[model samples]
Target: MKAAVAAILAGMVIAGGVSAQTAAPAVKEDFKPSSLNQPGQQFPQVNSQGYARFRIVAPDAQAVKVSLGLGGRGGTVLAKGADGIWTGTSEGPLDEGFHYYHLTVDGGTFNDPGTLNYFGSTRWESGIEIPANDAEFYALKSVPHGNVSQVLFPSPSTGAQRRAFVYTPPGYDAAAGTRYPVLYLQHGWGEDETAWSNQGHANLIMDNLIAAGKTRPFIIVMTYGMTNDARPGTLPNFDVKPFETVLVKELIPYIDGHFRTLSDRGHRAMAGLSMGGFETKAIAPKNLDTFAYIGLLSGGTFSLEDVNGTPGYKDKVKLTFVSFGSRELEGNRAGPPGQPRADPRVNAEALKGAGYNSAFYVSPNTGHEFLTWRRSLYQLAPLLFRD
Candidate 1:
């Protein structure tokens, strides 16, 4: 009887265990898609030498491709692995510069969920930092860095206070007795004062260039190019007149008053990109007494006739520099379509014909993008502040 009871007890324990297992919930069959893979998973890595290799796992995917741009060869790479991992090796050397790239999983734009962002450019999650060589335009170097200060001051033209960013050169206070020339830099469409220092890397570029003795030491004043009543990103309701008034009357006076500036056209200059380029042409010609040097990057609506028509065009301005990318026009081989294209060389010839001393530069293999502008700023900086 006791042996019979022991067997029954063991059987009961086994039955309870089975019941517990059966009562538990089943795992869900359908799972939501995730932007990133597991942490241990590896992706392509490239360096200044322009080499890249990516390890992607896409078990359920029939085909996977890696889209490359900027620092490396820009094309689609096919997946090669079988255990749900797609792998591809880039061909040839990549361009020695910062590039934006993403993954095309079955022709879908997917930013890598694992990597950190460079911010402002909003290109993608994953980015490869390319080291600058002698051949590169602006290489990173160890230099005494300057700080960028964003300040909001009263604007009498707009009636509402606006924003502007000031870039003081390294050792600004150390050179206490020294007053610096100021460059009033303006932003193009879809950008503000933040654009230059952010995507343009204006501060980093200036810091590196100044350290390398590539550019003259000066202060960069970046302000909102839009009018007071103007909506952000869209063109303002008023013409460029309000913008000009804001800069000349309110913005410049505020900056000059607050910061130690030379306060004359000889020690002051104006420059901008796209719409700002148009502003430079409009304001500098009329207020030649305010701005001596002018630099236009990527876009301008002025023709030789316009310059000739403007009052005091010849005697007012000292030097003019116009620049554009070789791949600026539509269907250009250097860049994608829909970029602004104005031939600086042609513009220079016209300006000379109009009795204005001008120089033009077209960077090879660049488009109407920040890459071109950054390089343009580096080149134009040295030419500034020179007697």
Candidate 2:
């Protein structure tokens, strides 16, 4: 899946707020500092309508533009003000949830000095938050939170120790002899292990779900999807076996042995977004004994043909959760090039028709952004680790 995340993000970042912003009332004046902003900064703000206003202080710079405001024509261009600060509003309203962006100052790319940084496109990019109506699901609440710890495991395949974030649910320590199911989550292309917790809020989502009694308690393990082997736009020749070996051969055993997990086929699952989704689709069906549940978020679809071809998919697979933002499925364009163009909805329906536990979901009024994946995880978590 090397560069696959980059490809998906390239196409996704540009499709922002295209259909969302329409002929409407004036942009609301209720702009508040982005939730992702640094503690004391107030430059980048988001209004109730999801319109983002940016303020950059670059007294000596000739030009400044925000890479995340209204895609296509070089994002939103900022005008120099009398105060020597650059300011601009997004050309259109952006989708709700987190968006990765950067500032172009005097023809050079740099992170927005105001907002917090997130790893995307293989670099630290500025991030902004547009509050979602269902944000409470992933929001930090008064409930007990899960622990996200970094683990260094020996990976003989790569000849080095690999790092992964392990999310052990709250009360994990109390249940001394109780073993839990495991979900091996993968981050998209160009992104590493941090994407799930840092950007997607996987831990928070799980905490809220477990707290509310909406889903069964399960451990979530996140790691890099091994996408750096190839550069962006070179996904055509990407190989899944290398990453599959790392995940199945090394990560699974290590987790089962070290953590109190139900190390069985029925208790394990795999899921990802974009390139990570692609990885889940490739690895799960073939390794039925390893993963019983599969999910793809704005990733690719698994046709009935794919299910029939995989030897034990029907018997071992428990759920096939397919999801995308309503915008990504516009004109039935789900998967990118190098994969089949079958609409995920149609494929999902086909799976259900063929007696598979397939669930399809769409995030309304959004594109291929984090909002899409966040909702996907929320919808998927409840269906996983179920016997």
Name the candidate that leads on lDDT.
2
| lDDT of the structure predicted as candidate 1 | 0.63
**TM-score of every candidate relative to the true structure:** 0.67, 0.94
Give the Cα lDDT of each candidate: 0.63, 0.84
Instruction: Write the residue-wise lDDT of candidate 1 on 1-387 in tens digits.
Output: 122112212211111000112232433323222112335534445433445556666788776665663222345576666577776655434443444456778767776543433332223235543333533444445779888998888987668988999999999978888889999998665356776876567888788878888788899999877732443323323377888888899888899888889898898999887556766766787888899898887645345766677677677767788876555532332211233334446768888777787877776555555666777788788888886
Determine the C-alpha RMSD for candidate 2 after optimal superposition of all C-alphas. Answer: 2.3
lDDT of candidate 2 over 277-366, digit per residue (tens):
878887898899889999988877788988998898888899999898887777534445555456778889999999999999999978
For model 1 the local lDDT of residue 136 reads 40
* Stretches of candidate 2 exceeding 4 Å from the true structure: 1-19, 332-340
Superposed Cα deviation of residue 201, candidate 2 (Å): 0.8
Candidate 1 clash total?
A: 2
Clash pairs (backbone) in predicted model 1: 44-53, 56-86
Give lDDT: candidate 1, residue 299.
Answer: 48
